[model samples]
Target: MSKTEVNIIDPSILEDLCNNVTDGKPVNFELPNHGILHIDKLLPFICVYRYSELDFYFARVIKTQASYIIVDDNTDISHLLEGIRLIMSAKFETFLVLECWPISSEDYTTFEIFCPAGKAPSTVKALEKGFKSLNETYPNIAVEVNDTHARYPDQLEPLLNVEESKKTGTLVIGLGIPTLYKNSKTNELYALFFREFYSVFSETIKRAIHEFIRVQTTDDFENYLMFGKTNIDEITLTSDAELAEISEGMSFLLRTTPVNSNEEWTNFKKNEFKKTPEFKYRLISLDSEIEKRKLYNIPIDKVDDPTIAFILRGKRLEIEKQLTMLEERGTKNFRFVGESLYGVIKKNVLEEAKHILAVYPKREERKSKERFNCHEFAAHAQKELDYYNTKFPNLDLTLEIRNDVAGIMVSKSKLLINNEINLDANRCDALIQHEVGTHILTYCNGKRQPLQQMYEGFEGYDQLQEGLAVIAEYLVGGLTVNRLRLLAGRVIAVESMVNGATFIRTFNLLRKEYGFSDRISYYISMRVYRGGGLTKDAVYLAGLIDLMAYLKAGGNLENLYTGKFNITHIELIEELLYRKVLKQPELPRFLERESVKERFKKLRNGIDITELVN
Candidate 1:
C-alpha cells in the first residue's frame, strides 16, 4: 500500500504526538539494543547514544521521522550504511525498524489487527508496540499493505462463503498493519541481511525481505538478491568432487621435511660460514602427483565456464610451481620463491620500511619470567581454539606440536606448533589472533564454502593471507613497534635477496644500520635466504601496505575473512557467489568483533604506525 491508501482517522492525534517533541528537551526511547535512542527536536535529528550497539557506524539519524529516513548532510545514502556491521538472524532479509514518538506511554493502548503477511514472529512484537500507539491515538491505522496480502483475505474470505456455516459468515479482515522503511541509518541492515541470505540465510528471511521490500522501501532489495534468476533452484556449472580432489592431491604432493636438518643448520650457523648456506629438499611423491594432475588434465577449451577453467588451470600452475619449488629447494643460486612476483616489495613498501626503521630502532624486551613456555602457548592456542569452536561447535580442532612450522595452520581442523620455543606472554595473544584468529578462522569459513579451493587458497592468495595475518595483529592490538619493525625488516631482507645481496650483507645491514640485535638479524636473514633468494617474506610488509589502503577505502574485511581470498580475487569471489559457484564465507568473526570496529574506523580515517613509536 502507498501513502494514498492510508486513512488517518484522527490526523490531529499524530500531529499532536509529533508536536510534543521539544527543542529544549528530547524524549528517549529504549531499544532492545544495548543503548538508548534519543529523539530530540524530532523529525531531523536523533542520536543513538552508545550507537555502537547496532554495529560500527557512528552517525546522527537523519530527517523525516514519519518515514524514519536518515541521510548525510548532503542527503547521500551511501555513507549511512558504509562499514556498518549488523548482527541479525541468518534466516531472512526482512527485519523491523523501531520508531518511537514523543507521545507518553499512558496515552497508548494496544490491540492486534490480523496481518497475515506481517505475521512473522521476528517482526510482530515491534508491530504490536507501534499498533498500540496507533490504536490509542487514531481511529484507523495508516498502513501500506502489499497487493498480495490485500488479495489474500479477498480469496480466503470468499472461499469461506462456500462453506455456508455460521463461522464462515463471521469474518474479520486483518489489514492496516503499518509499513516501515529502514531509513539510511537502518537501511544497512538490508545490505547486511542480503549478504547473510547468501553467505547466507533461511527461507523465512528471504520471504520477509522480499515482502518488506515490496511493502516498505521504494528500492528493490529483493529483486537485487534474485539477480536475474530464472527460477529458485539455480545450480552452478562446477563439480565439488573434482575441486576437492585437486585440492587434496596438491596438498599431498606438497609435503616435505625441513630442507636442512635443524642440527646441520645449527652447525652451519655455528661455523660462521661467511657464505650462503646450502641444504637439500625433496618432494615425496613428485611423479605420482604429476601423474594425477595429468589425469585431471585441465581442458580449458572444453570448459563451458570460465571460472571453473580459470580455477582449475590456476591450481595446475600452482601445482607445477610448487613442485619446482620443492625440487629446487636448497641449491646455490636456487630460486624457489613460489609466486615471487606477488611478493615484490614496491616503492611505497620501501618508503614505509624506511619510516618504520627510523621509528623503531631500539628493541623492546619483556621480563624473563613474563615469557610463556610452550605449555603456556598451547594453553593460549587452546583457549583461542575454544573461542572459535564455541562460535562454531562443529569445527573439530586438533592441536599438535610439530617441528615443521613455528606456528602453522595445517588445515581447517589442524594446527602445528614448533613446541621448541617459549613465547612472550605479551606476544601470545596476537599470535593466536594471527594464526588461529585469522588463518584458522578463514580456513573453517572456507571449509563451510562449497568450493574446496577456498581453504586451499587460489593463485595470488599468499599476499592477502599474510597481509590479513599482519592486519589481524594490528586489529587485536598485538602489533607492537618491534613487530612492525620486524615486518619492515622482512621486507628489507627480501629486497636484499632480490638484488642478490649476500646473507652476511643483509644480516649486517639489519644489525648495524637498522640497529637490530644479532639474533634478530640472523633470523630475518635466514628466512629471506632460506631457499637461496626466497622473496616471499617481502609480502608481510608489502601486503600490509596494500591491505591498509584497501581498508582505508572502506573495503569490507568481512569479505576477505570469508575465505582464503586475495584482494584481486574479491571480484572473482563475488562472481562465483553470484553464479552460485562458491558459498558465502561462514565465519567473519573479525568483522563481527566490537573490539575491532573502532580500529577499522580509525584505519579508515588514516593511521600511521611509525608515528606511534617515536
Candidate 2:
C-alpha cells in the first residue's frame, strides 16, 4: 500500500499515550526497551530521536521535552511513529515531527536541514531561518538547506507515509547536525563546552519551533519558554536533595564567623588598634575535600529539565566556592574567593554608604531610657514565635543564646543570640521582625516548597532576604537613623577591607573619621575582617538600595515571600508558579499588621531609604 512497509508496534503502547493525551493528562514513561517518552501536555509538535552511532552526542543535545520521543531500534522507530500519529489524532489539527540526527563531519560544525518535498514552502523557510539565525550565537557554525523525497536519517526508510501524513495534517523535517561536541579524531567529548552548546542549541530549536507554530499551526502559547519542560523528573528532584544535603552539612557563615570575636576585639583595642587581630574560627569537623567530593558526586547532567538543571548547576558552583573558601580560610586566597562569592563593593554602593554616614546626623539616633539584656530579648522573641505558631501551627523554630555568636543572627531555622547581647527595649519589636519575621519566616516558607534548595537558601539569596529583613524593621516602626548608620558603617568597613585596608586602619576609619563610637567601630571592623576579610556586610545596604528601587518600580513584596531567591529570580519564580511547579506561598505574618500595611502602601508608592527612618 505504502512505499515503506509499516511495522505495527505493540498496541498497548499506542493506547497508553493516546488515552492520556485524549484525557488532557501528562504522559511520562519508558516505552519498554525502546526509550523514554515524555509529554508535558498536548503540544502540537514532537521532537523525535532514533538510536544511532552518535547516540551519546545527540541524546544530550535534544532537550525540548514538552513533547518528545526517543527510541533504539527498528521496532522502537515503529513505536515512535505510531505514537506520533496517536498524539495527532487525539489533540491537534496540524502536527510537526522534528526528527534530529548527528552526522560525523571531521571538517567543521554545521547544521543541514532536510525538508520533505510536499510540506508548505513557508514551513521549510521557517526551519532554515531558525538554523541560519544560530549564526548570531554560534557564528562559526554553518547552515545548509536541502530538499529530500524522504525526511529521515541515514540507513532508515521513511518513518511516515507521505500520502497519509498529508491527509492527517502532519509534516516532518529532518535536521542533521555534525558532531562538533566531540573530537573528530579521538571521538572524545568536550563535556563542558558541549553542555554550554547544548543549552544554546536547545534554545535555537525552540526558536525555530516557535516560528513554525506561528506560520503553520494555530497552537496557542505565549513564547518559546512554554516549550521548556514543565515537569521535573526523579533525577532532578533527587539530585537537588543530595546537593541540599551537602549544603546543610556545611554552614558557611557559622563556620566562617570567628568563635573568639569578643576576645579578639578586646585584645585589638587593648593593643591600641595597632596590630591586626587573629580571629579564631570554628573548626570544621568534616573534611573539606570529602565535602567537595560529595558536591561532585551529584548527577546534575542526568537531569533533562533545562530550567531545573540550570538552577541546580548554579547552586553546585556556589557550594564549591564556599567549600574552597572554607579550606583557604586564614590564607591570602580566602579574601579573593570571598570577594568573588559575595561580590566586590561597587563605587556607587560605597558612595551611598559614605553619603548615609555624612548626611544622617548622630542626633537622629534613638534615645532610650531602658536597655534589655539577652534574656529579656529571648523571651520577647519566643513570644513572637508563639504568635506565628498559631498561624502556621507546626512552625518549628529554636532560640539559642550562645557565648560565641555575636549580636543576633538566624541560621537555618534557628535564631542564634549572643549571650552578652544588649538591646534598646524600644527596638526589640524591630529586631524581632528582622530576625524572626523575615529570615525564619522565609526559611519556613521554603520548607513547604518542592525544592529543598529553597529552604537551604538559593545561591545569592542573601541579598533579597537581608533586604526584606531590613524592610521588616522599617514596617514595625523601629528603623532608626542609628540603625541606618550601623548598616552604612558596615558597607564602609567592607569597602575599606576590600581596598587593602588593615583591621586597625578600617577601625580608625569607622571610629575617628566616621565618628562611630569605639564599641560600634570595633564590631564593624571585626565583622569585615573576619575569615580573612569578608565583603558580605555590604549586602545589607546594597540590598536595601536595590529593593528601594525595585519597590519604586512597583515590584511585588508578596512574591519575595515565595521562597529564598535573588531579585534576579523573580521572573523564573513567577514562571514556575504560573506552571504550578511551585506552590503559592501565603503572606508573612508581618504583612498582616495594620501598621505594616500602612507602611507597605507608602513603600509601594515609592518611599526612599532615608524616608524610611522612624
Candidate 3:
C-alpha cells in the first residue's frame, strides 16, 4: 500500500473486531516481509495508526496473540500509539513495527495504544484528520497521542479547543484513504503512506515551541501560587526549585559584598575625612598667647612667633628709646620729617628693586627709554608722597621728596617715603594708605604702650599686612578689576608653571593673551613661578576675599588701620573691638585731618605733586 493511503476505520468497528477475534484465543497478523509475531494473545492485537499528509499506517492481528504485536514499517510508533489511544478504547501490551525508508536502513517502531470498550471509528478519524490539518497549517510540528482515561477530562478539553490539533487530526483521516490501492507499485505505496504520516505528525515536529511555553508558563504559575506562601514562617512549604533560585540570588548579593552596617559606613566616611590636609594655622592658640602676654611690661618672647621676633629684633631698642624720650619730652605735638625716615625705608628698597629688575630687564645698555620713563614715574610718585606728608601735619606728618624709595612709615621724626616711587598709580595708592595709614598709625600707637612688640609685628602677619593694604585700596577707591585680574593671572601662571610649563610659555601667555605688557608679565610670572614651586600668588585673592567678608560684617576700617594691623593681629583686635575695650592712640601734633584728606585725595587720584610742592 502507498504511504499516503490511510485506512480510516471507525473506532467502534476496531473495538468490535478485537472482541470477536480475542474470544479467549490467540490471533496472528501476517507480515508482508516475513516478520515474526511477538505477541500470542488476541487481546494484544491493537491497531496502531498515524494520520498525516506525509505518511499513514496501521497494524492489525489476524488471530489471537500474546501481550504485544510487531509490525515492519520503518516509521515512528510512539507518536502513532499516542494518537490512537487518544481516540480509541483498546488495550494491549505493546505494538512494535519496523519501517524501511529510501534514505536510510530499516528501523523498528514501537507504540502502546490503550482504549476503552466502545471506541468509535469516527473518533479515530476525527483525531487523525485534526492532527494532519494542524501539520498542514504549521508544518514543523509532531502529534503525541495518549489515553486520557485516568486523567481528568479538563486536561484533554483544553487540547480539543486548540484549532490546530482538532482540524489537523480530522483532515488526516479523511485525506489519507487512498493507501489501499492494490495497483500501485510498492515504492509508490510506501511514498504515499510516508507522506501522509509526516503531514499528520508535523504539528508535533519541533519541541522548541512546547519547551518555551513550558518554561514561561511554569515560572508565572509558580510566582502566582507561591508569592505570599514563601514568606510565611509557619508554612515551610517552599519547593526545591524556589529555594534554588533564592540561593542563587543571595550568592550574587554576597559576591558584591555591599556595606550594610552603620559602623562600616561610618568607617568609610572617617577614612575619607582622614585624607584631607590639616590647616596650618590655628587662630585660637595664637590669640591665647597674644592675650596672655598683653599686660606684661617685658618684651614678648621671640620664640612665640618668628615674624614678630623678626620685626622686634630689627629696631626694638631704638623704637623703645624713641617712644620713651617722646613721652618724657612731653611731646604732645610733633611734625613728621619725611627725609629722617629714610633709614627704615632702605630695608625693603633693594628687595623691591630686585623684584622690578627681575620683571623688566634692560634690552639695550644705555639710557633705555623704559628705564628713564620708570624713573620719571618714580619722581612723580614722590611728589604725591611729599604732598601727603606735608598736608597731614596735624597728624605729625612731614613731606619730603628724595631719590631713595616710595613706601612710607611713621618714625619718631617723620613719615618716611622710599623716594623710589612705583609710577603705577594704583600700586602707589595701595602702598600709601596700606603702609602709611595702618602700619604707621599702629607703630605710633604701640609706642604708647610699654611693650614694643605691639608696634613691631605679629605672627603670620603677611596675610594681615597684604589683606589690610588691599582693603585700604578698596576703602580709598583704588582697588580696580584690572588689579584683581592681574592677581588672578599670577595665580594661573604659577599653577601652569608648576604643572611643567616653561618660563617662556608663562611670559608669552601673560603678555599676549592676558594683555599684560611684556615687562609686567615677565615680572609677575617670574615672581610667582621662579621660586621653586612657591604658592604665594594664591594669597592675594584669598586675602581679598577674606577682607571683603570682614568688612561686610560692619568691621571698622579706621580701627583696623589703627589696630596692631597684622593679618595675624585682626582676630584679637576684633575681639577687643567687639568687647568695646579697644584703645585709641594720642593724636600726633602735625597730623591734620583736613590736610591728610587732601593728600589722600591727590594720592587716590594719582596726581604727581612732588616737584610742585618742593
Evaluate model 1: give its lDDT. Answer: 0.52
TM-score of 2: 0.86
Judged by lDDT, which candidate is best? Answer: 2
Best by TM-score: 2
Please, what is the TM-score per model?
0.58, 0.86, 0.31
| Best first by lDDT, ranked | 2, 1, 3
Per-residue lDDT of candidate 3, residues 1-614 (tens digit): 67544333233533443554445323333333333222223221132222122232322211111222233343223333334333322332222121211111122122212222233334333344444454443343333344433211221111112234333321111111222211234423343334334333322211212222233233232211111101111111122122222222222111211222223324434664222111111111122233223312234221122222233433333233222322222122111211121111222322332333344333222221333234454454355445545634544544344433223444432445544433344445444565555555455565443333444443233445566665555545555544545555665665565556765677677766666665556556545432132344545544544555555555554555443444445654543333222455533222344654554444334431111110
- RMSDs, each prediction? 19.4, 4.0, 40.7
lDDT of each: 0.52, 0.78, 0.36
Lowest lDDT sum, 10 consecutive residues, model 1, at 80-89
Per-prediction tally of clashes = 4, 0, 94
**Deviation (Å) of 313 in candidate 2:** 2.7
Give the Å shift of residue 4 in candidate 1.
56
